[model samples]
Target: MVGRLRARANASMWVAPALILVLVFIYYPIIENVRLSFFSWSAFSPEPRPVGLDNYRALGSDPVFWRALGNNIGYAVVSLVFQVGLALVLAAVLEAYVGRRLRGLLRTIYFIPAVISITVAGMLFQFLYDPHIGLVNRFLGAVGLDSLQHSWLGDQDTAIWSVIAMSQWQSIGYTTMLFMVAIQRIPAELYESAHVDGAGRIRSFFVITVPMVREMTTLLVVVTISGAFLAFNEVMVMTGGGPANSSQVLGTWLYHSAFLNDDMGYAAAIATVIFVITLAASVIQLIRAQRRRVET
Candidate 1:
């Protein structure tokens, strides 16, 4: 009995450092942020004054906050459609149809943009969306679609969507690679058996490929949704939530409030909202995975 107790104690001792790091770096900051949300503070202020729920109350009436949240939701939907859904299909096609050498080359070509710095990608796309000399407009003019050309990023209506398109261009490749890895792990014999049973490629894909990669799909969905909510760099770099805050997302709005507007307390409240959303997504993923395990 003593030996078993000693072994358990030693295992805990080995885990202590990591546990401490997580508590200090992750949990402590989260708790601090939540506590800070209840206070009215600014960077210029000497101290935080307790404001109870005022900051959160303000959020309820803030039109910009609602617009930012709506943009985030739209971003999540588009990312789900293109990054998760379309990437999976592309990955499956590449894995099944392409030759090995050619597949590797194509993957490298696709993944190149993913490895590029987000800042660089943002800047590159910004120039591409410029009103006059931009490649997008030039291409439209070249193709005799000159009437369709407009200021892509400068226009209020097109600004957010243009940023989203840039993000999809940079991210689709990375998601495709992840899907390809998941698809490759599926057993070959399952596909062969499907083929033997007279199932076509598309039928086999829906039946075998997708079901087998459910875990990966779930993970990617959680990540993509959380990422969409937390998106800052691309918007900041490309539009700065600009042309009169038309493209603002939650993250940029938080930054704008905290630093630019000198409303740290309100920023903390926004942070709390982001945390709740991401945590909910994670919880949903865990519940679904557990239910699947139980069913199996």
Candidate 2:
């Protein structure tokens, strides 16, 4: 018993550093952020003044806040459609039909954009969306589609969607690769058996492939939604939440309120909202996963 206690102590000691880091960096910041949300403060101010729920109440009345939240929801919806839904289909196609060598090459080509820095990607797309010298406008004009060309990022109507399009280009490949991995894990014999039973590829995909990849789908859904809500760098680099705040998302709005506007408390409230949303997504994922485990 004494020797077992010593072994457990040693194991705990090995874990202590990581635990301490999480407490200091992650948990502490989360707690501090929540605490700060109830106070009115600025970086220049010596101390935070307790304001109760004033910041959150202010959020309810803020038009820009609503606009930013709506943009986030829109972003989430688009990501779900393209990044998760379309990517899954693409992954199935690549896995089921493509030759091995071609599959590897295509995956690498697609995933290349995901590896590029978001800042770099954002700047590249910003240049591409340029009204005057941009490749997009240039291509449209060259192809006799000049009527379709306009200021892509400069206009409020197309700004958010333009950013979202760029995001889909960068992200779809990564999600497709993840789905492909999940598909690969499925037993080959199952596909062979389905083939023997007269199942076409499409029928087999729906019956076998989709069900087998449920866990990956759930994970990707939660992650995509969380990331959509947390979107910042792309919008910042491309639009700066602008064209009259039309493209603003929750993250950029939080940054605007805190650093630019010197309203740290309100930013804290915004942060709290983001935290709640992401936490809820994670919780839902966990519950679904647990339920699946129970069913199995």
Candidate 3:
């Protein structure tokens, strides 16, 4: 009994640091966030008084909140449609036609964004969107579509699209490189056999490559969806969720409340809701993916 206890104690000593780290970093903040969500706290106030759901109630009536939700959904859909689809297509091309040198060069180009900070990307794009002197309008003018060039980040109607486009551009390279890597791992023999059986490039791709990369595609979908749901930094730095709050996402709104507006408790409530919604969506996707696997 003594030996067993001593052995167990020795084993637990190795886990002690990890447990303490988790308790301090993850568990502590989570508990505090939940606690704050039930109160009304501000930096100015001497106390964080218990408000008990008022923050949530306020969210129910806030049009900005609804707009943010709508924007986030739009962002997610657009990203899935353009970002991941573009990646998959590029990956397919690289797998089917590209040589080793070209593949290496393309891989380098695609990975540039993953290496750079998103904040720098956002700031760089802000300049490119400059209405009078910006590169976008300049291109439009040079192309004779001068009328089409409008305020990219400042105009209400076009600002959201501009931000979404920048985000897609930033994210696509990383995703394409990853997808291409996944596609490369698929057996050359499989393609050779398909070719031997008289399959064309498109046919072999659809018949073999597509099915092979389904797992990778699922993972990318999950990551893209999560990032879409939590998009904040770019919008904050680039747009400030502004031009009449046109591009506000839940993450930016939460930021404004927690840090800018000093409504820590209300921000906590929003964060909790964000967590729940994202969790539910992820669970649904997971269930659907499992069903898909079971079917095949």
Ranking by TM-score: 1, 2, 3
Cα error of candidate 1 at position 72, Å: 0.7
The sequence of per-residue lDDT tens digits that candidate 2 reaches over residues 47-115 is: 999999999999999999999999999999999999999999999999878999999999999999999
Q: Give the whole-model CA lDDT for all candidates, comma-separated.
A: 0.95, 0.96, 0.88
Residue pairs of candidate 2 with colliding backbone atoms: none
Q: Model 3 over residues 63-122: C-alpha lDDT tens digits?
A: 988888889999999999877787898888986779989888988887788778889999
TM-score of 3: 0.91
Where model 2 places Cα greater than 4 Å from the true spot, the runs are none
TM-score for each predicted model, relative to the true structure? 0.98, 0.97, 0.91
Residue lDDT tens for model 1, 221-276: 99999999999999999999988899999999999999999999999999999999
Record all residue pairs in model 3 with backbone atoms less than 3 Å apart, i.e. clashing.
none
